[model samples]
Target: MSTPVLVINSGSSSLKYQVVDADDGGALAVGLVERIGGSGHGRLTHTVDGEKHRSDVAVPDHAAAMAAMADAFEQHGPDLAAAGLVAVGHRVVQGGARFGHSVRVDEAALEIIEELSALAPLHNPANAAGIRVAMDTFPDLPHVAVFDTAFHLTMPEVAHTYAIDRQVAADHRIRRYGFHGTSHAYVSRQAAELLGKPLEETNVIVLHLGNGASACAVRAGVSVDTSMGLTPLEGLVMGTRSGDIDPAVVFHLARTAGMDIDAIDDLLNKRSGVLGLSGSQDMRDLVDAVEAGDADAQLALEVYCYRVRKYVGSYLAVLGRVDAIVFTAGIGENADEVRELSLRGLESLGIEVDGEANRARSKEPRDIATAASRVRVLVIPTNEELEIARDAVRVTGS
Candidate 1:
């Protein structure tokens, strides 16, 4: 068996992990610990070799969660010790401009990651917490950090810079640092492979449409432009995020409604998007509601898909000529109606989706565009964990 890498993706209240084989990109085990620090019982579910194991443990914090995860591995088969783990990979969301590639986690690296937490308040702290705990638990193993913003660092200034004063922006480190870099990089490369083209020669657009959505214009396997700006809240309409709203909206709310910055921030980041447009934020629920003739849901669907189409059009113009438009992540890969609606009326742009092909339900990557269509529309499921593991192996030279 090949040396496995333990990939950890720690969120605000959850920890997800996978043990992946470095040699062949196979998942040896996968698990999650949810509801951490919550009053109610936290849940730990682990799977090894397709056999599932679950526990309702009180995981009061990241440390406790890590211990429980170790317990799960011991109770389940394929223990970490037996797996011959080479390294532990942590998925850090915002690496900023400093980290353009994955690196071995050292004291200086950890300090930098903590310092950059200002750019990702919701993500970085949690990621750091996981890192600390993982380091303590697996003291002998090498730890690597694979950043989500690393791949997008290749974006040019025109695409990543804002229209604000250069001095002020530079002083504050305020520039577009697109999220989902790992997913974009993996999906775009997979799209090139699916098209039977070399990655360096491929020009593709990757639409990662989960609850948190973003579009990337990847030309010749590099991100020339992407939809997300300084934060994830600046991108496409997400489940709860109000993407691409006028900056004045916050000021308007503050002036007229006497809303504070924190309240306004919460409104835009936690209470907007499809959730604001319609009653529900879940795409599946919205689709069902649309079929049931819910006007609000229909409008929400229209607005969401329209935003996607606009980004696709913008990216098409950016790339000039596109090889494929790849759809990955939750809603992008599974929601057929969303894909169809997003790509509709783009035939003139050489983007056409075959109804039959688009409707096909499969996990494998496949083209959804008509043979006559100039640009291919494809659905490639994302594997961020695998990508993190691969990066970890590469950085550790394992």
Candidate 2:
């Protein structure tokens, strides 16, 4: 039996979607709509079985983007009406404390999602808009919201709470709400399966190292701790984000550098990290520069890896015993030098990477740990679309 679900990830001006099978976790078709409501015509690229169909047309809003997507499906292959799609899964970035799991989209749920926009000024509004437009487009299919923070909602209070003013924190809903939950959930389960162990019996540390990165400690299939907090900006050093910075730096910059809050926010979130440090954001380019003896690039790589090492060590202590340390996302899966550099001196922690295995490249899930290492080190590609699809199927009974 095949269970097809349409997974939608809506950004402020872009909508990326995929029709994935919940049974096998394979994408049937994938498409992306960009530049919605922009001055120029929006562009759409739809792929079916390795064949790509592209078009540039006007998409004035989320509604127009949805219409464009429908047109692409009609013109290309695997027509949505005949594709037997059971439900629509929306990837919501911030669910706050209200949504701890996937939920069927309804009036109340949509309202809550809209209200939470204050916490995620850039994401929730767009997600809610897309949900509204998608509901109107596919009125017959169930729409499920699979939040990125849902998986981390299982973290204990000790792991999630911050040492802040109790009244202020309560009033503002300030606490650790980790992002990249879908990737962490998918990678941890895949790691458990790769280790030939039951998920409930496994303790794994997942490093989702992409442009936006985070580390998660999953104990017995539940998230115990994670690196990211209140926003995606609090975790490991990323392509553009300055992670784990002292809060007083903001005040210092305000006083000394004459910078405002928004300026500091833009600096840390957009102009910092490896890009700010090395003058480049791409790891491939940065790695080449490091090889060519660029001092800035070398420092960037060291800083990035050092942050990762810190998280790994902390998670090891948090979990007490780890069965596998899994790496996923773009940089984690493809950058061998990063994998080696991050765990450079963790041999005593039973997390040693096999040189040959780590260097070897493949798309399939693999273990790169040495035989003598106590913990299995793995590289597993994240399938967030599939995870969202599965959650949608379960929530909607579709």
Best by TM-score: 2
Q: For model 2, how does the per-residue alpha-carbon lDDT over 269-302 read when each residue is reduced to its tens digit?
A: 9999999999999999999999999999999999
Please give, for residues 39-99, the per-residue lDDT of candidate 1 as tens digits: 9999999999899999999999999999989999999967677778889999999999999
Give the lowest summed-lDDT range of ten residues in model 1: 77-86
Question: Which structure among the candidates has the greatest lDDT?
Answer: 2
Candidate 1 achieves a global lDDT of: 0.93
TM-score of each: 0.98, 0.99
Clashes of each: 0, 0
The residue pairs that clash in candidate 1, if any, are none
